[model samples]
Target chain A: MRVLGVDPGLTRCGLGVIDAPAARTLTLIDVSVATSSADADAPDRLLAIADAIDAAILKHRPDAVAVERVFAQHNVRTVMGTGQVSGLVMVAARRAGLPVVLYTPSEVKAAVTGSGRADKAQVAYMVAKLLGLDEPPKPADAADALAIAITHALKGGGRTAASGASATPAQQRWVEAERAARRRN
Target chain B: MRVLGVDPGLTRCGLGVIDAPAARTLTLIDVSVATSSADADAPDRLLAIADAIDAAILKHRPDAVAVERVFAQHNVRTVMGTGQVSGLVMVAARRAGLPVVLYTPSEVKAAVTGSGRADKAQVAYMVAKLLGLDEPPKPADAADALAIAITHALKGGGRTAASGASATPAQQRWVEAERAARRRN
Candidate 1:
């Protein structure tokens, strides 16, 4: 199964693709996206984000999309930012006929690094190591995007043990694939 | 001008305080509210979030808070998560002494990154680089939180910017301290 992980933004939205095989190993495919404008009023900007999401869907052809869900942001303005990106991503996925799996920051952290309170550097480091990469992924956002995908791959009904630290080889392959894709991006 | 940004989450919430001094330099301070089953019931969770917001206000104190206005996500369950988080955060701000500054995601991206189509990472990177941070803040969620505060600093005036980035840091310190003293658990 192929999974696409996305980190949406206006200037640089990150996309990571991974092929999840049955052995728990992730087959890294590719990761890339544009950083446009994420302003609320710019319909053109929203279109760009939609286009980016569609492009990823068409290129990766992932069966599922693992997106980071936004909790309430203390600022209404910031939450609006979360909602706008989320809305565009959701629309693009729906249009592409892919299901979206939402993951909380903590859940993704725990799934990838065994700690919910893990920092971005830790999450990035774990993502690289999990995929057998020599260095942590750059553009930290992309690494996170990949982690979201890996976490879902581990949690999706295809898992062996269904919890932290027990992914099968196929699951492992999917995670590895995500890291490989990051470098290519 | 001082702007406060908040990323509200049921489990882990983020808070950021930024002083956009007129001297072309920025001072940024951020924090997080870590909760784990601390709220026994739905209401309790709401209150916990509210209290967290209050705590943020007391700690970072800003003339205005830029929050992302809440939107109903695709799934009802997800929408509930967004709404509850927003409600508590907003309530806390009102209960404190600050006026709320709301913006849509696109607006924030446009205001911060000069585009409405940017993703969270793009925004965060620009936010960090623009504010002079060597690296982007962790957990996209916290980055979003910082975005909210920066939004207020940039917009010029919604409620108080009319008073200036209300441009001094002393007022910010006072408001933050008051909120801290009145903190409720």
Candidate 2:
């Protein structure tokens, strides 16, 4: 399954594409950040981000799009921007006839680092290790985008059971963590 | 000048169009509310609202678009949706090559009823009187939308000077209130 993940924001939106070749194997297809000027009007900034997302969807042709869900509890200042960008992302995916799945930050962390409360560094390290990259993707947002994609690829839409049988030791841990998170929920 | 004003929301978005003829005289061109089901996904909801605004713009061919500014300070639960829809409105206006303007609720109220803190009823009453309608538009949203359009027509984007000389007694009060509001700002 090929998945496109987005960490939505008005100033800077992170995007990652990955291909799950096998149940336990993953390949990094693309990663980039889309940014807009702070000086621009809100609509223009959103339009720019929308264009970038649409371009990614056209280029990658991912089976599904994964996005970080915006919560009203935190980031009081940027929550609106995050929500607006998330809206644009969902619309772009839907327009392309692809399903969109949203994951919370904690869910992405647990999927990548085996801990819902994992810090940024730990999540970044795990993302780099899982994708077989020499280092974690830069600017944090990129890694986060990949982490969201990884979460969907591993356990999105309640499809976790299919990959359980072929899991390696590390994949087994993620599966266990996901199960725990589900139970907690 | 013809202005399309939007009071954006995810559940029900209010839209009003008006033509400013002979400085102070106003004509109501159109008023309608676009709605989306709460059961639909956020992206789909936004797209539906976007389509409505686009259709209005295409049909009215308004010279400018005006929208209520979404503030993070209020409506914590629905702020995100409001912001997202507002973004969509601005994008549609920009896409149609129409200038977009934003007015605060207080500004709209002040422009219509000569008081920034005026209640909804007062604003609605003044909207009907200004537009020479038999009664105020139904669904407070409709009235608010027209009020916003009236605000733009009366004093938007630092264009308050032109209409000042020919102001009637009521128009004079609105102009004075607007100046006071600007001074306070």
Candidate 3:
């Protein structure tokens, strides 16, 4: 089973896909962030986001998606960004007919590093080590995404599921939009 | 110009459209909740949600969009719902290229009833009197949506303006999306 770990973010969404099977090694098939201009229209940028998701789905075809379940309701700006990130990922996962699972940060930490209150660095170190990676993942966000994938995979023993995808029609449509940027280029 | 106002939600989404230049009389186009099995597959349901938004757009080619803005960081569940509702709205607005303006609840109340802190009943009363309707709009949510449309028109002074809708890819995608959804539907 192939699992895609996603760090939902506004500027950069770190993605890491692990192919699970005989070799339990979690390989980093891809890593990058999806960005949109702050001054640009939110809708068109959303389409570009959908396009990126479609491209990722086509490239990996992962069976499931793992997202970090948010526990705290931070400030307004942060919440808005998190919402945007979650929205794009939800739209993309649904479009590709993949299941999505969410894990709380603490749950992920405890599962990965044996500490419910493990910090980001500790969790990242454990994630890379547990996944059998040579070096720690570059970005802290990327490592968190990997842990989300690993936690869900551990919960599923490996599979994609979306017991939590409840987006509106508008969300689906915006996701349908392909990248206008790519066409121009 | 016919303006559609949507209060999007997973269990219940309120929709209202008003014909401008006709004394601003609102035609209670449709009011209902879009529901799916809660325990159903998440991705499939999200796809269905997209279908629902398209249906609304095709049914009512709104010239502009007015939606309620998400304010304050509520509980986790409520916050999550706000994200879902906002995402759906952004998608729907982008698909039609219809300029969208968001109004805080207070603004809507103030515009409709001359008081930002007005209650649902007070706003409803104002809507009924302003439209010269026999009765207040049924389904409080629908009335809220209509109020949002009225607020935008009154505030915009009949011009189509929104925060996002520039020459950037994100803006273009949303503007073109309205056309695309129209053509497809």
Candidate 4:
């Protein structure tokens, strides 16, 4: 299955596509970031990001979309922008008849680095190693996007075991870590 | 000028269109609410709201779009959904080549009624009186949507005096009241 991962943000949104042939096996297809000028009008900025995501969905035709779940507990100003962009991503995925799944940051980190509290550098390193890339994806957002896609792919597409009832040992650990992180927040 | 106002929400989104023939004179063109079930998926809910807003933009062909500005300081759970819907509305307006303006709840209240602190009932009463309707628009969301449209019309479309540099006496008062409300919050 092919998955498109979106690290949604108004200023710089990351888009990454990967082909998951089997469990714990992945191949990178495409990765890029969409950006808009802060000086532009709010509507124009959002439309620009929407156009980028639409173009990617048309180009890649991924089977499902995975987006970073935004929490209001984050930065007050940036969270709104993140939520807005996530909304656009979900709508675009649904319009294309693709399933949309959201993975928390800790879930992504745990899926890739074996630690829910892994720092960005560790997550990026694992993403590079897992995808067999020469180096980590440029910028943190791009790496995060790929991490989200990897999380969805390894978790059985996030549909069959959303409650972690039928998850593997590794997947169950990730779920437990996510719950702990939420409680800490 | 014809203005389409959007009171954005996840479960229920309000849309109102009005024609401003002259300053302080308005006619109600359309008013309705778009609803989605809470049991539905997140993507489905957002797409339903987006489709309704897109249809209204196509059907009404408004010159400008006005939406209630969402504040993150409000309800944590509801604010995210509000921001998401507002993003969709702004994107639709821009896609149709119409200018989009955002008015805070206080600004809408100040424009429709004399005080920024006016309650929902007062704002609805003023919206009905200004539109020459026998009764206020049904549902508080509908009235709030119309009130946003009326605010844009009364404020000269929100393009010329965005900084309040060239605002009229009434608009200047509204701007001051908005600042006071912000400070109080």
Candidate 5:
């Protein structure tokens, strides 16, 4: 299954696409960011984001779309922007006939790193190893988007058992992924 | 000029259309609410809202769109939903080549009822009086939407001085509107 993951934001939204053939295999298909200037009007910025996501959906034709859920934060303006982008992406995904799922930051971290409290560096490192990339994806947002996609592909695709340190191949993949993350860190 | 006012929400977004021939003259063209079920998936709910707003824009073809600017609140989920709807309406309005403006709740209240701290009843009463309607619009959401349109027409349409009690004809309109509100209360 090909999954598109979106880390929604107004200034810089991250997009990542990955194909998972089996529980133990993952391949990175594409990664990019959608950006809008802060000086532009709110409507124009929103349109720029919507158009970029629409293009990504058309280009990748992912089987499923996963979006990072916006959480309550101190900055109301930032939270508002995040929520708006999330809504736009979700609607666009549904319009394209793709099922949409939302994952919280902890959910993504637990799924990918076997710990809900994993830091950004650890998550990015795991993402690189999981996708067999030479280096971690840059700009943190791109790595986050890829992590969300990997989490959904592993969990939603119904190919992996519940996560743990057990010797199951899924667990083993995570262990290796974690080890790679440690090495890179 | 025709103005479309949107009170944004995820479950029930209120829409109001009004014709502003002059700063003092206004007519209500339409008032309604767009609803979505909480049981529906997020994407589907978002789509329902988008579709409803899109249809309103196509049907009304307003010259300007006014959306209630989302404010910080304790309810994160509610704020997120409201922000999403606001973004969708603004983008759709721009796509239709209409100018979009955002009014704070206090601004709408002051414009309609002569007090930024006016309660819902006061705003509703003024909305009914301003539109010369025999009865107040049902469903507070619809009434708020109408109030928003009236505020934009009174302010953005260049009828009133900057929100004060000077006895311009615009101020006179406010005095009458406020008197009407007090009578209803």
Candidate 6:
């Protein structure tokens, strides 16, 4: 299943696309960061990010989108930027008729590194190992985006077997999560 | 000068359009709220807002857009919603090549009510009086939106005389404020 992950930010938004065939095999498809200058006006900067996200969605056409859910309670300025970009990503994915799943940082860490308490370095190492890359992804943001995509592939959501897509551990996890969500609701 | 005002929110985004021929005489062109249901998914709700904003901008063809600048430091969830909608409005306006300005609540109040600490009722009353409306606009959101446009008209920015727009008290105030902002900058 192909999943596009977005680590939303204002100054720099990280995007990573990965193809995870099954439970353990993962292949890196693409990764990049969309940066906006602070000198520019707010509208221009936001439009730049929005356009970049729209272009990525058009180019990748991922089966699903996973965004790191922003907790705006911690920092006001940073959270506003993250929250705005996250909303833009969600809208873009939905416009393409793709399901969007939000994962907390702890969830991504636990899914990738086997522990929610794992440090950033550990998560990055696990991502590199999972993708069978010679070196860890640079700038942490790119790696975090890949980690988020991997988390969704492994423990959150992905394609279904009925939709001409093969089943994997990701589907099973998605089913469980949906059932839990239904129960809580 | 045509002005579009946006009172950004997740549940109900208020939009107001006014034509200030000379700034002091305001004619209400349109006023409405774009609502998103809480029961719907996040992406769908945000898309609804984005589409509504885009439609308003296209239909009104305003020369300027004014949005309430959200301060996310207050309430996390509420601020996130407001900030996201605000960003969407700015992008839509920018896409239409309309200049956008952000005004704080205090600025709006000061511009309309002659006091930064004015209450909502005072602002609403001033909005009605300034627009020559028989009654105060229903739903405080709509009134607040009109106040935002009025603030931009009076204190921040407006179409210049070179654009075939005439002068008024609002333009004089805006010029003074612009000089003050330039000095501070």
lDDT of 3 by residue, B30-86 (tens): 544455555665445445665666677788887777777765465556555555556
Order of candidate numbers by lDDT, starting with the best: 4, 5, 6, 2, 3, 1
Candidates in descending TM-score order: 6, 4, 5, 2, 3, 1
Across B4-103, the per-residue lDDT of candidate 2 in tens digits comes to 9899998989999999965479999999999998776666677788889999999999977889988776888888788888877876776786667778
lDDT (tens digit, per residue) of candidate 6 on B56-141: 89898987888987888777657877888888887788778777877778878999999999999999999999999988887998
TM, every model: 0.44, 0.83, 0.77, 0.87, 0.84, 0.87
List model 3 lDDT by residue over A64-86, tens digit each: 77776643366566666566556
* Candidate 4 chain B weakest lDDT stretch, 10 residues: B159-168
TM-score of chain B of 6: 0.85
By DockQ, the candidates rank as: 6, 4, 5, 2, 3, 1
lDDT by residue (tens digit), candidate 4, A1-185: 89899999999999999999885789999999999987776777899999999999999999888999888878998888889999999889888988788888898999999999999999999989999999999888899899989988887674424421224355457667777877999
Q: Give per-residue CA lDDT, model 1, range B77-177, as digits (tens).
A: 44544544654455445545455555667877887889999988899898897678999888777788777777766655343222212223554565556
Residue A89, model 1, lDDT: 60
Worst 10 residues of 5 chain B by lDDT: B158-167
The chain A TM-scores for the candidates, taken one by one, are: 0.77, 0.85, 0.75, 0.86, 0.83, 0.86
Off by over 4 Å in 4: A160-185, B160-185
List runs of model 6 lying over 4 Å from the truth. Answer: A156-185, B156-185
lDDT digits (tens) for residues B1-185 of candidate 4: 89999999999999999999785789999999999887777788899999999999999999888999888878997888889999999888878977788888898899889899999999999999999999988899999899999999887674434421223355457677777777999
Q: What tens digits encode model 2's per-residue C-alpha lDDT throughout A71-160?
A: 766788998889888877876777787767778899899998899999999998988899999999988899999998999887733433
Q: After the best TM-score superposition of candidate 3, give how far the Cα of residue B98 lies from its true spot, in angstroms.
A: 3.0
Please tell me the interface RMSD, in Å, for model 4: 5.2
| Alpha-carbon runs more than 4 Å astray in model 1 | A38-41, A74-76, A157-185, B1-185
Candidate lDDT scores, in order, read 0.65, 0.82, 0.65, 0.86, 0.83, 0.83
- Which residue pairs clash in candidate 2? none
DockQ per model, Cα: 0.02, 0.28, 0.24, 0.38, 0.30, 0.40
Quote model 2's TM-score: 0.83
Which candidate comes out best when scored by lDDT?
A: 4
